[model samples]
Target: MWHDKSVAFRLVRKKDVQETGELEAQARVDRRTKNLTKRLQPGNIAVINHSDIDRVSAEALVECKPRAVLNAAKSTSGRYPNLGPGILETAGIPLIDDLGPEIMDIREGDILHIEDARVYRGDELIAEGTVQTEETIAASQEAARAGMSVQLKAFATNTMEYVEREQDLIFDGVGVPDVKTNFEGRHVLVVVRGYRYKEDLAALRPYIREYKPIMIGVDGGADAILEEGFQLDMIVGDMDSVSDKALTSGAEIIVHAYRDGRAPGRKRVQDLGVEHVVFPVTGTSEDVAMLLADDKGAQLIVAVGTHNTLIEFLDKGRSGMASTFLTRLAIGGKLIDAKGVSQLYRSRISNWQIFFLVVAGCVAIVAALAATATGHALFGLISTWFGDIVHWFATLF
Candidate 1:
């Protein structure tokens, strides 16, 4: 069934052999895009196993400025309309798709040459894959759009199933753990490592400064908070994608564990000698962050970089966003998206503007004084005093 579906949307070639210009670069291979990004240097080929590469991962890859990308998995599985491949292709990064598991056979730091959609090691052809061009990507995207109705139906069905199973989250707010971070009657900013989180955070600088909300970062979102020059009050997640630096950033850590009480990330935090608390829950870390804030009586919950749309949920490749959907329903009027807030909220007055206003006011006062008769008398007295001071200085010299 999978084979038939893949075959239906397979790239149709004009010619069997298209001229792919010879390109030589060192290869950095990893099944995980996040881990690979740290090792990727400019001009090196990034080999990854990410399927339906999400926007955030693609943005991270693009920042490294790699010569090309070689994938062991499909960049777009026609599951949903993911923008990752388009982002890479638009940035002029050649994405070689589904080179098969054999592509992983190439060791790290190996020098490689790409020619005509084939990878070579020292003049020997090691692997071959489909070279994703703009045309092929556009076609795949169009097909994905056409398939959305089907995907949405499946998503809705799954969401309903999960909602039936997890009604406690909506009604009773079960599994919400107590933490030291206070949210009572105060604004709480819950950040997730999703679509344009950085831009959204940048836009919320004024809100963050004025309100001084309790800052909560979920996984890599903690790193995002630190990158924006803010201190995190709490870091909640499975702790997979967050950096060691962020973990040690003195923020209180809350590890999200499975319902069976198995916390895989707890050991890492322990190894780092950092103090942390374990919150066993079934849903995602972002879901837990919102639930935690909401349950603790947060006046308002401002979310940054959270996945709210159907396309984003589909890009995550989940059966359904049941926990997120229910969590939002539970929170109700308390939650506000950062994207909307960032657009609507503006800084009342900047420091520079206030400084200029003060200077302008002073200048106007000086001008007014200079035009008055009393001002002339004052100036004459000031000049006499200045002359006496000058004479005194000369006499001393």
Candidate 2:
């Protein structure tokens, strides 16, 4: 049956996005959902995660750039981000948020139409009006808020698991030899999230002319190292907000734990089938990474994007980064902050030195040219061409 609807167009269902918040907010989504979103290409239809018209503006809605957004979320019409009609009004893409099970009834390739929040086939109206104008936005917001809380709770739950594992590690300890190894043997670039990690890396590049260090990314710092085209040697974090690509990267994984002694990343490691080590303690992943390397006998530790002040720790949403402070104390002698080193070791070539180098180069070139046969001929040719000009100038004088 078909209904008297206007916004009907024919297109194939491209990708099935069960959730939209993950991609938009850069938050964690289920593995299957994550895979689906990554696989979603351009010109594909997307299902809306939530229908909150008021929370998001119409301009923000257009940014999703979908052919048409199917709102699976409940929200009020007055809400800014969820107002489908206003969003589609200028963008020209159809808005279909509140159609009930009728949405499932439509085949993936079947042509459909929408008019005044109603769906139709050809001439028959399939379904009319599903989303409420005022309540949908509030409902969607509540759902999102609830979902975020659950995620946070999950993180907390894993923290407890990390603590138990730390106890075992403390009692058991690593067996065999504890012989330390020199870090100079390996490329060990300490990765930090600094105010100027990019600038520091550029300045320190000269030192890399001789020996490059193995890049170690701490948590989200993995993204920073990847941008530099270097393979991450190791990643230390609690598995929150980091991309899956970073986790599955060839880098060795180390999970940082809370002082309650928990290693929360073990499950993710097992799920991804990656080899990992658990270093449970009260510190950020960056701190644990340094400890692991230093204890293993690294000759030098280079840090980038590291928080060096009490205020820096606070900004990172940490109650206390004391563990980081202490760990640095234990290895400060060999530890070098990449940013600090860059500032101190930057090449200070003076203008006079540059001038001398240029002059020396010119003199060497002239000395060599003066003895060459071709040079003599070239000079003779130049002299003859200039002699006429000089004679003319003398006559004029």
Candidate 3:
């Protein structure tokens, strides 16, 4: 009976469980969004502690192309409708919001698996957080827009405070530092790394080529100038985010120091052995650039990428934009936004356009000649010469 017994064959297959599990990706974490973005690579998840992330920072993050963003703090804290989170979310990058300080426990370069609102490390659950979907972000943005009045009131209050404190420097330029760079009786172009800066610069190409204004780049704007194949006449900033290439680009450097005589960026410039002058004052580097240009007696100051709106000032997340508000007031008639200038001034006709115009004029002249009796004789002679040349070529062939 045992020898006659045949073994029944059966087959079993394992389910594909991993396919439906949490999304697994590596992470790059930093308390500072700027610093984190430097090391962020495509497909790496970004964990940041930035609150009310600005548009510039969001654009930087989007450029890195991360798989997802995990924020330890609020991306938009209803602070005047910041464009950062919306920018990230619209780019199709998933955002896990308000993960709390516990999320920081995840080390840089650690593998993470995210599902729903939970972040896990292998089999162990690490943290639970709110995932920012389009609807949630839109609601937050709407709330922020509603809160704009409060922000505006606060901004106005701050501007008045700054104006009262720094009123003397506004008019008399008593505390402004003297530099070797002369802006007297010449146009000065002050460039900042604000919204649509590259586009504004492109639009100003003809103006830059023609007027040849004294080019002053504020921090990273110096790199932008260098990128556009233009010479940097002077670079004015705190010297935090600019590149070494820009530092060595033969432009005059001015280190913006604090009012207490503490210049954090000075040592970096000094260590690089680049010649620079220290402008010790209050307010932002942009404020300093405008004051410098104004004090140096610039005939006109054209600003590129400078923050002009309430949202822009808020996006900077600095109360010191009060200085910018005052700076604009101080330099009133002389200062104009690049956008305004670009609109007002017509660009000179390009060389190619001139060439085409010349060609068209020659063709018109030829047609005019063809309509006249002298032209008929000239055409006949030219035809005879062409026929002789064709005959010669035909005989040679």
Candidate 4:
């Protein structure tokens, strides 16, 4: 009794979905997008991979609007709390994950039936499958938890190596200056590389005069500062991504380093004849930027596009997210993530508009779908309707 009511649609790969899922989870963990916490909207079904359902974008499924989420990930075997199908259940979204890589092979316009999990390509049946069960979802949670532990361990090792190098550098007396900062009454803005910095900076132009924070750019952030037509008071980082103009922008330079005494990015500063000081430690350039501001007694540190999550570090091919995690901890009170500030302080889409758009879109989709009648009949109907409407308007005029 299979009905031919198939809906034509695009098939996104399970892998890509999983990657986004993990990114979402990491975003939540680092509190990068905390204002959007646990406010799941109804009737929006998100498709995700089981591997990414736990520590990363799991919060998305929990917070966003999703009626029933489709898990396009690996089978549940090991288990964890938030990683498996149980997470979906906890959030009241049905968990149907680990259908397999075979799902990736499905083509656009293929029909996927919910009751039996059978996929049909056009007029031909390709594969028959079943939805994941509760036990399998539990095992997936365990696997996710275990995997996170391994990733954290790898980060610890990387941090240790960085620390060892820092020790050696200190022995040679080639580290950051003990000079105190005198922002006593001046507004200080310590810029970092984090999300939507370009757009945020563009919107902040008018307010720049009001706050008047002395701009301190961290590495690539100097480029952003220059792009905003603002002078950089100081440029901090390894000096890898700062531009020639930023180097000569009359800003002080700071080179971040480890205990090994090697400042890899220092050569770039020297080549440009830029004055700089070495801030040697076991941390990322972002961390060094924050410390430089705090130690120098800056009024506030305003960060942007800085890697603040486990997934963000993984995206950069690092074993651990130690630097970012620790950096936030050290700069707790004075630090402010620009993303949160932007969302809260900046313009946002209104709830009424979102609802109106959703309703309008659904109506348009249904109307468009109802118009088709073997192509020929539909064209004739449209022509006749157009003529009648024009004739009626002409008569009225």
Candidate 5:
């Protein structure tokens, strides 16, 4: 009877196997890829609704080490050469694109399995999409390069419109509110969540330690500064990207209430009971931070993770990239980029500092001499002897 029961259990196990999946893993879904990545674990599938995914976003995903990425929307829509799809492919992570909106319906923590392009829940197929490989991503990027001219033309038009409307703001520094942080004659480092920010910040650690500049983190960049073990002096951005801990980290918060960023930006800060200054600007928060630094007399502004190349703006898909040019023009030569500055100049104990230390020590000797009358008589005698020697030396010459 025990042998018969064992055979029945085996049959039941076999039946369940046919109904279940071979490559089962939990699903982590979010419409916003950035928010999802915060809790995304290794060996878990990431379901996102990102379209034309940019490089920075892709880099964030790769860092999370997800098993597979399922995009509900197209990863590359031939708009421009977006680097996210290729980055995921090169990292050896399975990227299934255009899985349709139904993939988002998969409950969070649901045990899911992926086979080829298809995603399944037990025996039922949930969603299917085109699997991205190296060849497909390369072809898509090549095709996307052709769209750059169109993007450029649009960028120029947007830039021109911005200049016409915000001429007073950029040149006159209008609407840049005063901050509690004293930036006068001090080096200010403004960090943004763009380009190679992680590496740039790593490079600037020496500079940061030596200069002890006022640290201003723009949005997610605030988290970057805290991660580096430095106190964040200021955070300039809409309230969406930064952590609540950063808001309460004693850094003066400046909320960028841009055209559409006004209401939601203010409310989030209010909910968190974070006291903030609302500066309504027309351009990006990074630009606004630079302008504020320039207006408040920052001696040298070192920028990190900012857009320095044309391809970068395109990669981020920002049409208002011309604002970057305008902001630089407004700040003149005082603002310098920190991307390669670390490689160019490593901070060290300089000769000037040593010289100043010696000078400080000499001050005491001078003070001691001035306090005694005998010191004055000795100075006079030494001067007469030195004058006679100078006269004899002149006769010999």
Candidate 6:
């Protein structure tokens, strides 16, 4: 499933590191890996400042096909077995760990040489860090598992705090802003650009067709829906990662604001002059989208690419994940994942339909054949054969 690590990641091999003078590539620097990835081109080196990088960020880096990743912070801080380092290693990308904050000083488009895991500009060596290998990543991940209990305990505490704070919104749906797009009595497809989202959304094409779901995209997920050529009805998120094209897409926007009503996304939406509402709730945007759908009386909420597991929530690296747990509990009966619906909800073709289709096909072939000149002779021969077969059967009986 992984490419050869020795291909580009041979910097770990001391002898081979000297064999290849140094791997030089253009640097794309950003404190945030996700933001940097948007501008990242193939073969460009990514310089980021993420600690214990999550799975989504790692996958984004891999998708950009970065030749190498130079992190300014720890890639895996032995915290809850975060899947980032392992993902980067498995993708054959060199993850140079914790080169220091000075690594961020490398300007975008600056050509840097990576020799024995040391980043140098021309004659000047700027930074040096550990060249993460498969063994190291695996070891870190194994050690990180012990921290899972700690993470879980913290998550439980946060969940309780959030539930207490948002009791009215969670239990009574007191402040869920109404959207123009009616979800009442309809199946709402809430898309989040999470694990296998594109693939899972593609898998739900037939479901989308049959149910004509009210498609809602959470953050960058709006672009995913647009990419699939589906008509997006509503978009729910902070409006940071989403494209301007999506904001101006005429979809009803519901900006998830902070508890105090500081809606930064509202300004962007207002500037676009599009119809939007701000729902000041203290939870993740995906949770808000689901809660809105459920509040609006959506018959069913089908989630695509949502983080469901303990590991996934941990990978998100946010205390807000507790809201997801509580949100699921709030609307578990009305909600289903895309994979679940794909597996359990078969296409609604009836047995009668299949029988009629077979019969119709046979009739069409027989009628066409009978309309020919040789058809009369063929029918006579068929009748004779049928009589002979019946006579033989009668004798056997």
Clashing pairs in 3: none
The TM-score that candidate 4 achieves is 0.47
| lDDT minimum window of 10 residues, candidate 6 | 1-10
For model 6, residues 168-261, the per-residue Cα lDDT tens digits are 9987899887678888899999999888788789888988999899999999999999999999999999998899999998898899899999
What C-alpha lDDT do the candidate models reach, one value each?
A: 0.83, 0.55, 0.84, 0.57, 0.83, 0.86
Rate residue 120 of model 1 by lDDT.
79
**What are the RMSDs of all candidates, in order?**
7.7, 13.7, 10.1, 16.7, 15.8, 9.9
Q: TM-scores of all models?
A: 0.81, 0.45, 0.79, 0.47, 0.79, 0.82
List model 5 lDDT by residue over 348-393, tens digit each. Answer: 8799998998998899887787689988888788999999999999
Instruction: Give the lDDT ranking, best first.
Output: 6, 3, 1, 5, 4, 2
- Best-fitting candidate, scored by TM-score: 6
What clash count goes with each model? 0, 34, 0, 31, 0, 0
**Cα lDDT of model 1 by residue, 179-224, tens digit:** 7877889999998988778888989899999999999999989988
Estimate the TM-score for candidate 6.
0.82
TM-score-better candidate, 4 vs 5:
5
What lDDT does model 6 reach? 0.86
Error of 6 at 137 (Å): 0.3
Error of 1 at 106 (Å): 1.6
The RMSD (Cα, Å) of candidate 1 is 7.7
